[model samples]
Target: MATASVVVPAREEAARLERTLASLGRQSFDGRLEVIVVASGAATLRIAREHGVVDRVLTDDRRDGPGAARNRGAAVATGDVLLFTDADTIVPSTWVRRHWRHYATPAVVGVGGPLRPLADGLSHRVRFRLLSDWWYRISWSVGFVQQPGPNCSVRRSAFEAVDGFDESLPFLEDTDLSLRLREAGRVAYDPDCPVRTSVRRHEREGYLPLLLAYLVGYLEYALPGRSPTREHFS
Candidate 1:
């Protein structure tokens, strides 16, 4: 069995971080699973420290971005597979196992799963089903694979080959990494290994504005000669 490292990047996620860590503790994977939390705020660090399931905790005082935080966690990880997920997401018990199974294929470099809404609100469900579920499926079918940060995993060798996520990209760094990973090998989509992610951002920032921001970011990433700005999202 291949060892795996689960990297979670957190900011001021005191209220939600515990749940994520607890969910990780329940993973049914048979291989050695290392859970690392890269946190920015004091409260987030405290919560991570209190979580007995966490194997390591690294502080990111720079508050650069999730991409940078994930990079820091990935740097010290000693696993064959590096799994990336948000502190606001709750993964299923078989999440790590499902991701690890894909690595049995030597040509598969990365695997991305679906993100279901944690909140039961109608709008939340609709947004996830449309924007996340359907979107990932269709895009992968067309050879334009994209892995959302909240639920994705990649082989450490391929990840290192591509030099990891672009810290310079504030919003669509995951998508950018997915595009580059295609050069290394195949990037796959696994719809069965779904993770439940918080919809608090949409609730706080409003649905249309958040959607529009991602749309613009996607366009900027897809179109030629256009660079991604340093615009931050929270």
Candidate 2:
């Protein structure tokens, strides 16, 4: 069995981090799977230790961004495969295995899964579903496959070859990494490895504004000679 290092990037989310940790604790993967939580503060470290699900805890005082935090964590991960997910996601028990199964093909360097909304509200669910489909379409139309950032895994070598996540971008780091990873090898999407991520971003920012922001970002990426959008999305 192959080993994997699960990297979670968080910022002041100690209160909600436990739920994600608990979900990870329930994974049935029997191989060497280690959880590394990269937190931007001391508070998150304390929370990660309390949950006791993480094998390693890293602290980044810079508080640069999720991409920086994840890069820092990936630097010290002990596994050949690095799994990246948000602290706000609840991964299914078979999440690791689903990603692991694809490694049987030597040409496969990365795998991305779907993001399902955990919110019970009908409107929230509908919004999340639409956004999910939009992301899938964006990945296809862009000509570079991108899996959901909150639930994706890549071989460490390929990640390093592509220079890892682009920390310079405040948003769309996943898309940047996906495009670069595609250059190294085949990047795949497996629907069975879906993770449940919080829909609070849409809930807080309003769906229309969030959608518009994403469209603008995609446009910037699609246009030639145009600079990438530097706007940050929370």
Candidate 3:
């Protein structure tokens, strides 16, 4: 019976934080669950408390990047398992349970699930979900399984073994973590444990460009400096 800590790194995401916490509150896990929200603003802290779901909240006034914020939360986490998700992600009722069940096998060091890109319109939802689901399925089936940061979990020991996420990476940090996790032990991908994530990146930057940027980031992660493109959080 391993306890779990859910860390959500937020940067001025008060609006979405409410929904994210709401979803977490609905989770069906019976284990000792600890939820921490590492946010940068007073508003975020207020919203987090308003939701009345999180077990703990860390106020980082520096507004550090996702990796930094998450690392800060991980440092204080007191659990055998560490689960990471974004402030904009709406996890299913079985999200925590699904990830925890994977740890039943000793060889499983980390577990990653698929992303369900959310949209308002019916057409938009269908289009984004189909493409994203297909892409993740193919990527996971191929061996270089990349976990969406908003829907991934790792054993505390294994996470400490890889030294956790690299705080310097502005983007594609999850992919880098995945590579190191694979070296330690098996990293399982469960399509059934999908999480609903915002498509705001594509909505703000255009779908094609966002997709191209992710592909470029993946290449850079796979091939290092040889890749023609560089990652940018902006």
Q: In terms of lDDT, which candidate is strongest? A: 1
Superposed on all Cα atoms, model 1 deviates from the true structure by an RMSD in Å of: 3.6
Model 3's C-alpha root-mean-square deviation from the true structure amounts to 3.7
Tell me model 3's lDDT, rounded to 2 decimals: 0.82
* Candidate 1 colliding pairs: none
In model 3, which regions exceed 4 Å deviation? 223-234
Estimate, for each residue in 6-102, the C-alpha lDDT of model 2 and write its tens digit. Answer: 9999899876788898988988887988999988666778988777678988877889998899999999998878999898889999988889888
For all predicted structures, in order, the TM-scores are 0.94, 0.91, 0.90
CA deviation > 4 Å runs, candidate 1: 228-234
Ranking of predictions according to TM-score: 1, 2, 3
> Tens digits of per-residue lDDT for model 3 on 1-234?
568999999888987888899999998998888899998777888887666678888898776588888888899999888999999999999999999999999999899887777667775577666655667677667656567789999889999999998876778878777767877888898878889889888689987788789888666655646422232211
Q: State model 2's lDDT.
A: 0.82
Tell me the TM-score of model 2: 0.91
Candidate models: Cα lDDT each = 0.90, 0.82, 0.82
